[model samples]
Target: MTTLPQFALTVLGLLFCAGDVAALALLLTWQERAPSPDARRLRLLRGVLPASALLLALLLLAVVQLALL
Candidate 1:
């Protein structure tokens, strides 16, 4: 029988990664005003990029554990 913690982890991991990916798509395709290279670099250095990277790292860790289990 599946336990609650496993089920919740699966749900939360997928949701977190999906949201992170969607945010990346939106940022990459933004049409309102194109961000300059410097602006993009600054944005990454400041917050969004690093945070997304962390999300990816966390997701990878979760998937690896899920697979081992």
Candidate 2:
């Protein structure tokens, strides 16, 4: 029972981070034909990177807690 939240959070966080990375990769490719990426896209990437980092940190914390249990 105690493990349920930890497990769920870990899985969800990983999925979120993975999706963010994939999106960022796809967005980067969009700049290949241009001299620079659009300002809007850059702003979006900036927002996503921080969110992914925070989620990854949470996921790591959850894994550590699960291991300690």
Candidate 3:
């Protein structure tokens, strides 16, 4: 199979990085001070965010920047 063009790959990497940053921010700051009614949902998100960040990290790292030849 043909590889994606360099620009497409770079875009994918940026998206992954953005998602990871957003998740990291939510995990660190947004949930700390908010007093919401749905404690159960908040707990669920706490569990989910770390895993999502890890996945995004892996995806972002897998984008090899090999086009600078």
Scored by TM-score, the top model is 1
| TM-score for each predicted model, relative to the true structure | 0.50, 0.48, 0.45
Which residue pairs in model 3 clash with each other? Answer: none
TM-score, cand. 1 vs. native: 0.50
lDDT for each of the candidates? 0.68, 0.62, 0.62
Error of 2 at 25 (Å): 0.3
Candidate 2, residues 43-68: lDDT per residue as tens digits?
Answer: 55675457656656765675565566
Tell how far residue 67 is off in model 3, in angstroms. 8.4
Cα lDDT, model 3, residue 41 = 62
Backbone clash tally (model 1)? 0
The list of candidate 2 runs beyond 4 A from truth reads 35-69
Ranked by lDDT, top first: 1, 2, 3
Residue 9, model 1, lDDT = 74
Error of 3 at 39 (Å): 12
Instruction: Please give the lDDT score for candidate 1.
Output: 0.68
Model 3's alpha-carbon lDDT is: 0.62
